[model samples]
Target: MKAYPITTRYIKRGEDFIPIIIDAIRNSGIKLEDGDFIVLSEKMVSTAEGNFVDESKFEPGILAYFCYYWSKYLWGYALGKLLNIKEEKIKNLRKLPKKETLRHKETVIRTVGLRYALKPYAEGGLDLTNVPGTYVSPLPKDPKKWAERLYNEVKKEFGVDVVVMVADTDATYRIFKWYITALPYAINGIISGIGVLGFLLGRLAEIFKVGGFAGCTPLAIAGNKVYKNYSIDQFVRIAFICDRVHNTIKNINEVLEKYNSYVITEEILEKLKHTPVVVVKIKEEYIPNR
Candidate 1:
């Protein structure tokens, strides 16, 4: 299994990710073959898909306020404490409303239990540095769409049997878990629930060290044995190895935790300023055959 880092200027809106990736791999002197899996940064895909929200246009509805005051205090504080966040921030976060709170507990439990949790890895949530006023960039609504487009592009350009996985580099802070949330060639609607389940399961695999395979529960069940020979399978393995990567959550307390140095390259930051797709590719064998 091999992982290659392909860095370049930001990918603008409508930029075809397939060409960028192929060119990058070629430039790196790595030849790709059929069955290879590409692990892309999700922000890049979101950006290309116009999945970002300008903070200047942010509208914190009643829900946002509720999150800010209620959930922040209760669930945010509790979770922060559970995750070992600092005392002061917990206090501050506790003042926030539940709906206004960006982090939700029941949502976490339902979505992926404790497996798919996130702390702000970057400083853009309520930033004055990058944007003029306070603003937060919410998660993308359709990660799978971004993935499918890239997958089709790859197939058409290289004519290889490949899979495209969009991920977040921030996901790797506590663990190297890249967000895998789309499938390109399945029954469209039937694939939806499966995609969500697989994505959450992938997070579970990372937090709990369950498996390195990249798909869902079925993958966990079926690919259990053969996950080591392929890159996607290796994803399941890493996720499995990092088992139970749970963070804390509570709705009864107020807490605020700050991690200031979450690093995004200035290059990538500028790109994200306008769009979110960050592309990178890895070989089928990056994870060894178990």
Candidate 2:
């Protein structure tokens, strides 16, 4: 399989994503063909759809405060021991900033639910890694529809029929053929929700053998005949390869620090080549058996 990262200008809210994707493909100089898969970061889609929350506008409730304190001070050790989380991460959890952490937790509870707000980061696929301060991107409301739309739009504009997969950077755990993730919503037959409890159980299951953090979560897939029989492991492996190529910068902080800006300003984004879309070529021989 061959993967090509398509670089383009930064995407903004309410902007038409199909055009941006077309521009990226043109600039990358890679011609699309039948059976090709287009992998897009969920953040890119969310941002384009204006699916984000500004934490400053919301008030932290009592439940949010309690959960934050318990996770940081008490629950961290228990979960750490159970899941074999790194000592460094456990220690960092204990030192979470009070004000900001509360705000984040409150936002999570309000948006997704308490079950999801309990996770450490990327709760219910609500991500803060790529966005600026006080701003978090929520998972697309209708990922399947988004995938279908993108697939149809690509076919209309480029005249090439291809599969579209929207994915998240969050790692999914695998136990044999079963894929488990802590995300609140279900995707591609993977079990979700149960939050930190799911992480613990998945790790415990791994102790038996052949299970652990696999790769990026495949949130939605549309088009293509081969994908119908794809296993969770296959989705993860391909998604990981696609994610590594699409990320131009390491994290949002790096971009902020580079430009000395609070948010992802137009100037900073314009200065860097952003690769949000990736073309993945899948050979028939490379498709893993279900």
Instruction: Give the winner by TM-score.
Output: 2
- Evaluate all candidate structures by whole-model CA lDDT and list the values in order: 0.38, 0.77
**Candidate 1, poorest ten consecutive residues by summed lDDT:** 216-225
Instruction: Give the per-residue lDDT of model 1 (tens digit) for 91-162.
Output: 655553333234332233223222222321121111112221122222334656655666677667667655
Expressed as tens digits, the lDDT of each residue in 89-152 for candidate 2 is 6776776767777888999889888877777655778877566556888887777887888889
Residue pairs in clash, model 2: none
Point out where model 2 deviates above 4 Å: 75-78, 86-88, 248-273, 284-290
Q: At residue 157, what lDDT does model 2 achieve?
A: 78
Q: List where candidate 1 sits over 4 angstroms from the true fold.
A: 58-62, 83-149, 152-159, 168-268, 271-290
Worst 10 residues of 2 by lDDT: 247-256
Evaluate model 1: give its lDDT. Answer: 0.38
